[model samples]
Target chain A: MDKDTLLDCHRRISPHIHRTPVFSSRSLNRMAGADMVFKCENFQRGGSFKPRGAVNAILCLTEEQQEKGVVTHSSGNFAQALSLAAGRIGVQAYIVMPSNAPQVKKNAVMEYGGEIIECDPTLAARESEAARIVKETGATFIHPSNDMDVIVGQGTACLELLEEEQNLHYVVAPVGGGGLIAGTALAAYYFGKGCAVVGGEPIAVDDAYRSLKSGKIESNKTTDTIADGLKTQLGDKNFPILQKHVESIVRVTESEIIEAMRLIWERMKIVVEPSSAVALAAVLKEREKFENQKVGIILSGGNVDFRFKGRP
Target chain B: MDKDTLLDCHRRISPHIHRTPVFSSRSLNRMAGADMVFKCENFQRGGSFKPRGAVNAILCLTEEQQEKGVVTHSSGNFAQALSLAAGRIGVQAYIVMPSNAPQVKKNAVMEYGGEIIECDPTLAARESEAARIVKETGATFIHPSNDMDVIVGQGTACLELLEEEQNLHYVVAPVGGGGLIAGTALAAYYFGKGCAVVGGEPIAVDDAYRSLKSGKIESNKTTDTIADGLKTQLGDKNFPILQKHVESIVRVTESEIIEAMRLIWERMKIVVEPSSAVALAAVLKEREKFENQKVGIILSGGNVDFRFKGRP
Candidate 1:
């Protein structure tokens, strides 16, 4: 993607994304060995940073494209985000999920007026059904990642975070499909390249970490972690941007993820999903590099079910 | 207290108390027969409106009073708030809590650097233990409600709500020790008496509702509800204020509390403790009076464990 185009994406979707608050934590700072400023994307609309990219994807569609609707295969935050943002902007959204997706996510999509299409759990089954839905309905396919518009939307987080604190010495976020980090890095490149943009991951699904290190998108055959949102493979679009821009990739254990989640809840008193816990895990896991530096951690999402463990 | 003192508190603690956002749900409107604006006190500092009173109580202490440290007996939120706020300003905090209080609350007190002295469930045991702790430690007792400073702190929420939207039609909140209602009534008195203040209670602990009817503080023989915070009888200081300021009281069943909690988490996407649910439950149960009018329901706290039954 061209620099000017990325800048235009930032400009076009400016009003849609929430300029979430930057919170200071004396307790976290003392604990993490750094002065910490948390950009509260956990409080974002649809309860995650997906709205940025979801809106970007919907907004980029030709007027005719949005009218026909958009389809994606996500059982969680992405489904809810697409349904909500698309619904807000008068775009119909078709959510494709496995038949056994959580009732909560299903109810959320329906509440937002998203059309649901069920498939078996295999990727093959989902892709075939998603293809059929698009062909029959004439809807555009808004891949959760691997799309330019969505990448730009996710980048707005960096734009908003940078807008709040321009001189931050470091920026950290968890990496999954890399849409968020890619966008974050783009925003940091234009507004804050003087600062470091780092990525975090659970060692269980270290695809993003390995991909950034090896200069290729990587995948885990069978991932295992309690953070359902971080199970996706790095997208082709996301991998390049991350390989070039993300300063470092840190891996945290499952224990670290749970510990970080609890620690953040105890101190910050905010309801953060485990994906958001990843960025916090990085800061807590790698304390030496953060000492005395003004660090920014993007709490990417807060869509975790308090009642049930989401990951398989 | 004088009008100037109460008004002064409104100004002093304005920045500290989150003018908590008011959320409305069209779906909830359909169910409750009103366009409801839920004031999210669950999002407040220390996860309840208790901090407003706790902070106010701590801030108003004389230099001599401050040196003595602050002591309070609370089963939950007040303990956490007193611990958190008092510790922040370098004031020593001692909390007396029943041994049966949730693990989360115990964690909060310790996290806030409070010294917790466990006591039996009975008020007699709690009071004696608290007095003993205060005398031994040379601490000043900051009663959770039956005190002017706590009432003043609780009043700040009403002040902010009224200040933001002066013509609000009805205000509702759960009745515990009546600190919140006492504060709210005073705030509502200054803006508009035409706006009715509704106190909500669970049937299991309907003491406040009965007290308002009998023209005296009432006590429950035994309390049974997930809303542990709302199980207390009205205090001497707060009941009179409730009598003078409140317009009416409403009661909800135990099941309604769970349903109300689910409504908040599902629709507004906010995690509210069971105590916060009672206010919403009142509006939900008595759908007629609130219908079409602008109503404000304070989601007083979010410290409840969001556990579904059958969880380990």
Candidate 2:
């Protein structure tokens, strides 16, 4: 997409999303030996940046499509985002979630007024259930990350970050379904003076890293990472954007992800999911390239399941 | 302290402390049944509002006292704040922490360049150890929450809050050593137009409530609360301020505090210590009294020791 397209999408979704704040920690800077600015999407509505895309995709839909409602299959932040976005826009949202999904996730979607359609705990089952709902209710199916409108909407976060801190040398984002990284790359390419885009991926599910090396979208053989959100493979729509704009993809191990997540929570005093920590892990893993440079990292989400207990 | 005293303290400590942001949540507002603004001191330097007081206390010290260094007996946020504040101001800090204090806390104190002297866990031992250190080294002793300089410093948080949201109907703070609440009460009295001050005390250690009723300083028979930072009793210096200006004290049970803390983590996506949640818990417990009113709650700190593990 061009600059106007991204700018237009941002303007369209401005009223529906939060311009989440940018946070920095001296301890974190010392640890990485880099000047880092964290764009905290953990503070965004639905506790993630998914709302940017979900709202944009829904808002871009035709009146007829809007009236028919929107449907998606996700047991993660996207479900909550779509549900909340649709509810706010006075549109119905049908979330097809696996029956084995966490009850808290289900409750969150329902709290946002989304109707949950349960299916078997598999991609085939989820997709089939979503298709069935679309046929039965004339609902429009919105891919969590594959859709272009969603990608453009997701780019607005980086747009907001760059607007506030224009001199960032590099912009980093976690590679999930590739939407966030692709959108971030596009934003940096167009708006950033000379900012290079980078992706942080889990070594267990390094599809984006492999995809970039192979010059095509790649699939993951196993999704066995603590960063659960980054398990999905890249799609055709966003793959090309990553290929064109993204400079490199850095892979981090599970321990590295966990350590980074803990550091952010302990040092920054903010709750962030493991997927969001992947970016910081990547930066710390390869600090020499980023040392003494101003870098921006997107904390993609904060929907962590933490149990509060009595002090030890 | 009057308005000018508070103002001057804020200005003096302004360069050293953060003008922490005020956060609001629709979900929390809905639950509390009042429009609430959270003055997030949890995001402050040293992960608490203790720096405002620690820095002010250090800065107010005479040139000779600063040269001799500062000393305090604590194993909490104040220890870290004092260490960090002293380090920043180029003064030596001798922190008399109990030998049984958490290793992580000790590491934090050393990381901020504070020298730690181990003492027994009892209050008497802590005081004696601190006094011995003072005698041995001639270091100026700074109380965690008792001294007038520290109290005025702590009040600057409420002053910053009032500056941003002047029309708040009431300001609520957790009463521990009484410094935070006393400062908040004075800030509201001077800066807010008819704004009332409220204290949120743990039901398990409701010394503040009892003291307010008895018209004298009172001690807790048993300091058994999940909010570890708030286990101490109010001091004479701050107790008088609380008695004169605080409108009421609301006590919240352990369960209510846990629930409020969980809500902030789950919905607000910020890591707040249990003591910070006490203010919100009190407001939710007394919802009818604050119905449709604008309330300000100071989230006291976010230095929680949470163990991050694999997802269930």
Candidate 3:
């Protein structure tokens, strides 16, 4: 997608989303040995950047299409994002999740007024069910990351950061389904003076990191990372964007992500989930390289169940 | 004690402290059935509103007095606040704490350049130690909540909240040493258009509530509450201020505080300590009273040991 389309998508979704705040920490700056601005998408509507894409996709649809509604299959933030975004604009959202998905996740979707269709716990089952729903109800199936409108919409966050701090040397985001980082890369390419876009991913599921090297989509054999959000593989639509515009991917360990997450929670006084911490972990891991440089980090989301671990 | 002093304190301390953001939560508003604005002093410099008072008190000192330095005895947010505030003004801070105080609290004070003087864990021991330090070094003793300058400094948070939204019906804050609520009461009295200021206290340490009722200072029989910050009884200076301008104090159970804390952490994506949650808990307890009205809450601090509770 071009910058013009990205700008247009930002305009379309601007009225629906929060222009999330960019928070700076002197203590965190001392730790990272760099000047860093955190774009707190954890405070975004639906508690993640997922709503940026979900809202854009829904808004781009025709009146007839909106009435038919939209559908997506996910067991994470996107489920709530689609539900909340669709509900905001007077559209019905069909969220397809694994039957074994946690009750908290199901409850959040329900709270957002989404209709949940539970399928067997498999990728094939999820895709097939989504397809069946699209066929039966004439609902549009919006992929969590791969769609063009969604990617452009997700780019608006980086657009905002760049607009706020135009002199940023680099922009970083955690690579989940490649939506946030892909869009971020494009925003930096178009708006930044010479800013490079970096992706942070868990070493346990370094599909995006490997995919860039392989010049193709790569899958993880094991999803053993604590950052559960980054387990998904990169998509065909966003992979080319990432490969062409993105600079590199930084891999961090589970313990490192947790440590970074704790630092942000303690110092910044903000609650960010594990996925968001990966980007800060990447910065902390390579502190010397970023010394005295201005960097922007997208805190992807803050939607974790507090019952298992009292603070989210 | 008056609007002029509070306004002067705000002006003097504004350069040293953060004008922390006021955040609103739709989920919280829905739950309370009212419009609530949270003055996020949890995100304030030093991770609490203590610095507002600390900085103002230090700055109000004469040049010679500042040169002599300042001292306080505490094992909580005040210890760090004094250290950081004094450090910012290039003054020495003597922080006397019980030997049994948490090592993390000690480290934070040290990080802020406070010289820690270890004393016994008793209140008498703390006061005697602080007295001895002042007697020897001639350092000005600054009470955490009992001083005139400090009370005026603490009032600035409410001043800012009122300045931002002048039509608030009620302002609520967790009462520790009664400084924040007392200041809030004065600010509301002088600035708010018919605004009523309320204090929230832990049922475990309902000294302020009893003090207000009995028209005299009262001690807590047991500091059984999880809100460690509110364990202190109202001092002579702030108690009278609280009695005069404060409407009433609301007492919340431990479980209620935890529930309110969780709702904020879950929905607002902000980290607030149990003490900060007390105010919101009080509001939730009296939901009908605040229904359809505009309310402001001071989130006192975000300084909590997550290592013990995993997350707060």
Which model scores highest in DockQ? Answer: 2
* Model 3 pairs whose backbones collide: none
Q: Estimated TM-score per prediction?
A: 0.89, 0.97, 0.98
Q: Report the poorest 10 consecutive residues by lDDT, candidate 2 chain A.
A: A303-312
lDDT of 3 by residue, A235-282 (tens): 988999999999999999888898899898899999999999999999
Interface Cα RMSD, each model: 5.3, 1.9, 2.9
Shift of residue A88 alpha carbon in model 2, Å: 2.1
Off by over 4 Å in 2: A309-312, B309-312
Real contacts recovered, all predictions: 0.06, 0.75, 0.56
Per-model TM-score (chain A alone): 0.95, 0.98, 0.97
- Model 3 bad stretches (over 4 Å): A308-312, B308-312
Superposed Cα deviation of residue A265, candidate 3 (Å)? 0.2
lDDT values, one for every candidate:
0.82, 0.93, 0.92
Comparing candidate 2 with candidate 3, which one achieves the higher TM-score?
3
**Which residue pairs collide, candidate 2?**
none
Candidate 2: tens digits of C-alpha lDDT, residues A1-312: 689999999999999999999999999999999999999999999999999999999999999999999999998999999999999999999999999999999999999999999999999999999999999999999999999999999999999999999999999999989999989999999999999999999999998999899888889999899898888988989999998999999999998999898889888889899999999999999989999999999999999886755642
